[model samples]
Target: MFAEIITIGDEILIGQIIDTNSAFIAQELNKIGVSVYQISSVQDDRAHILKALREAESRSDIVIVTGGLGPTKDDITKHTLCEYFGDTLVENHEVLLHVEEIFKKYISSPISELNRQQAWVLSRAEVLHNEYGTAPGMWIQRNGKVVVSLPGVPFEMKHLITTKVVPRIIEGFKRPFIVHKTMITYGMGESAIAEILEPVEVRLPSEVKLAYLPSLGSVRLRLTGKGPDKDQLNALVQSEANKIKALLGNLIYGEDGGEPIEELVANLLIQKNMTLGTAESFTGGRIAQKITSIPGASAYFKGSVVSYATQTKIEVLKVPQALIEQYSVVSAQVAEAMASNLRALLKTDFAIATTGNAGPTKGDADVEVGTVYIAIASPKRVIVEKYLMGSQRDRVVQKSVNKAFELLQKEILKL
Candidate 1:
C-alpha cells in the first residue's frame, strides 16, 4: 500500500519552522510496508489545503494530514476536513474528558473556552485519543480510502501514530514484505563505483533496486527489495550483495545503515585485542573524537595528542626538530615520526598520525594548501602517504580523516 503526507503550515513555507513531521511519518510508514507516494507542504490558507487534500486522495490509498488542528482561529484544518467529509462539528464527551484530564495535570488556572472547544470534533469521524495533547486525532473513511488527521506537534503526532494508527493499518491491510541492505565504500567517487558495479547492477532482479548515495569521500550502495515471500526476498538481496562484494572486496568497508569507517576500525581493534592512539596536526583531534564517539571505546582506544604547533610536536610528541628542518612539517617523514612516537608513548599496538596544511592559504612552511601526509604505525612497520586534497579547509580536514581511517583499516587487515 501507498500513502501521501501533507504538512499544513505557513511557517514551514516561510522558513520559520522545519517540517520534520513528513520524514518521521515516512519512516514509520516504510517500517509497516507502506511506501510513501509523495510528501507535500501547503500554506495555512483553506483553499490551498482543500486542493492538496483532493489531489492526495485521488492518487493515494491513505492520506495523512498534520498541522492547523489547534483551537485557534488560524487553525483551519479541522474545519476544512469537516467541509471535505460533508459533515458538521459536534462535541464529544469522551474527548472532553481527555482534554480536561490533560488540563488538570498541567494547568494551575481554570481552562478557558478556547481550550474547551478542543473536544468538539467532526461527527462523521472516529476520534483517536491523544494522550500527549488536548487536540485529539481523527480517522475518516470515504470510498474505501482512509484519511487520518493529526496534530502538528511532533511528539503528539508520533504518539498518536504509534499507539493508534499503525496497529489499525496492519490489521486492515495485507502488505508485502520490504527489505533494505546498504554497503559502505570509501576512497572512490560515485561514478567510479557505479562503473565498477555496472555488471552487477544490470543483472539485478526486477524486485530489487540499487541506489548510490555519495557523501564527501564515500558512497553508500543501498539495495531495496519488495516481495510477498520474506525469505525469498532476503535471499535475493543477499545474492546480489555477494555479487557486489566479490567485485569490490575490501573496498566495501561495512554494510547496513552505512556505518562509519571509525566504527569498523574500532571493531577490528577490539577483535584483535589491541589498542590504538593518534597524534594529529591538521585534523585537530577529529580522529580521536570519531573514535571516542563509539560506546565502550576506552577498551581499545588509548588517547590522542593534538600537537598542532611545531614546538608542541617537538616538546610533547618528541618529533625531532632537525627532522622538521630537513623536511617540511607537512612531509611524510614527519607524519611517520609522529605515528611512531604516538605508538611508543601511548604503548598501543597501533597508531595513526596526520600532518598537513588545511587552509585557504599556504602556510609558513612554503607548502601548498591541502597538502596532507598520513601515516600508520603498526607493530611491525610504519607506512606513510601524501595527498593533495581540495583548497577548502573543512573539506580537506574531512577528506584527511576519511583517508586516515581507510589506511588504518588496510593495515589492520594486513596483520
Candidate 2:
C-alpha cells in the first residue's frame, strides 16, 4: 500500500522546530510494507492544510497528519480534518475524564475550560487514546481511505503509532514480508566491494536486491528480500548472504545488521580476557570514547590518556622530550612510545595510541595535513603504520579512529 505524510506547523518552516515525526512515521510505515509516496510540511494556515490533504487523499491509500492538535487557537488540524470529512466536533466523556486525570495526577493546575477543550474530538472519528499526553490521536476513514491524525510531540506520536496505529493496520491489511541483511566491511571502498560482488548481484532473484551504503573508510552491503511467505523470503536472503560471505571472507566482519567495529573488538577482548588502554593525541580521545560505549567495557578497559599537547605527552604519558625533538610529535616513533608507555602505565595487555596533524592549516607539526601515525602495542611487540587521510579535519579524525580499531583487531586475533 502507498501512504503520504503531512506535517503541519509554521515552526517547521521557520526552523524553530525540526520535523522529526515524518522520518519516524515513514520508517514505521515501511516496516508494515507501506511505501511512502511523499512527505510534506505546511504552515498552520487552514487553506494550505486542506490543499495538502486533498492532494494526498487523491493518490494515497493512507494519509498521516501530525501537529497543530493543541488547545491554542493556532491549533487547527482537528477542526480542518472535521471540515474535510464533513463532520463536527463533540465532547467525548472518556477523553474528558482522561484529560482531568492527567491534570490531577501530574499537572498541578485545575482543569480550565481551555484544558477541557482537549476532550472535544471529531464526532465521526475513532479516538486513539493518549496515555502519555493530553492530545489524543484520531483515526478517520472515508471511501476506503484512511487518515490518521497524531500529536506532533515525538514521544506521543511514537506511542500512538506503535501501540494504536500499527496493530490496526496489521489487522486491516495484508502486507508483504520484508527482510534485510547487512554486511559491514572495513578497509574497503564501496566501488571495490561492488566490483567484487558483481557476480552475486547479477544472479540475485527478482524479489531480492542489494544496496551499498558507504561511510568514511567502510562499506555496508545490505540485502533486502520481499515476498508473501516470510520463511521462504528469509531462507532466500540467507542463502544469498552465505554466497557473498564465501566470496568476501574476512573482509566481511559482521552481518544481519552488522555490529559496530567497537562492539566486535569488545567481544574479542572479553573472550580472550585481555585489558586495553589508549593514549590519544590529535585524535582527541575518540577511540577511547567509542570503546567505552559498549556495555561491560569496564571488565577489559583500563583507562585512557588524552595527551593533546607536546607538554602533556611528555609529562603525562612520559614520552621523552628528546624523542619529540628528534622527530616531530606526529611521528611513528612518538606514537609507538605513547602506546608502549600507556600499556605499561595502565597495566593493560594491549594499548592503542595515535598522533596526527589534521587541519585546515599546518599546526604545531611540520607534517602536511591528514598525516597520521597509529600504533598498537601488543604483548608481543609494538606495531605502527602511517597514512594520509583526507584533508577535512573531521574526516581525518574519524578515519584515524577506524584504522586504529582495524589494526588493533588484527593484532588481537594474533594474540
Per-candidate Cα lDDT values, in order, are: 0.92, 0.92
For all predicted structures, in order, the TM-scores are 0.93, 0.93
Q: Which pairs of residues collide in model 2?
A: none
Error of model 2, residue 66, in angstroms: 1.5
How far off is model 2, as Cα RMSD?
2.0
Model 1 gets an lDDT of: 0.92
TM-score of 1: 0.93
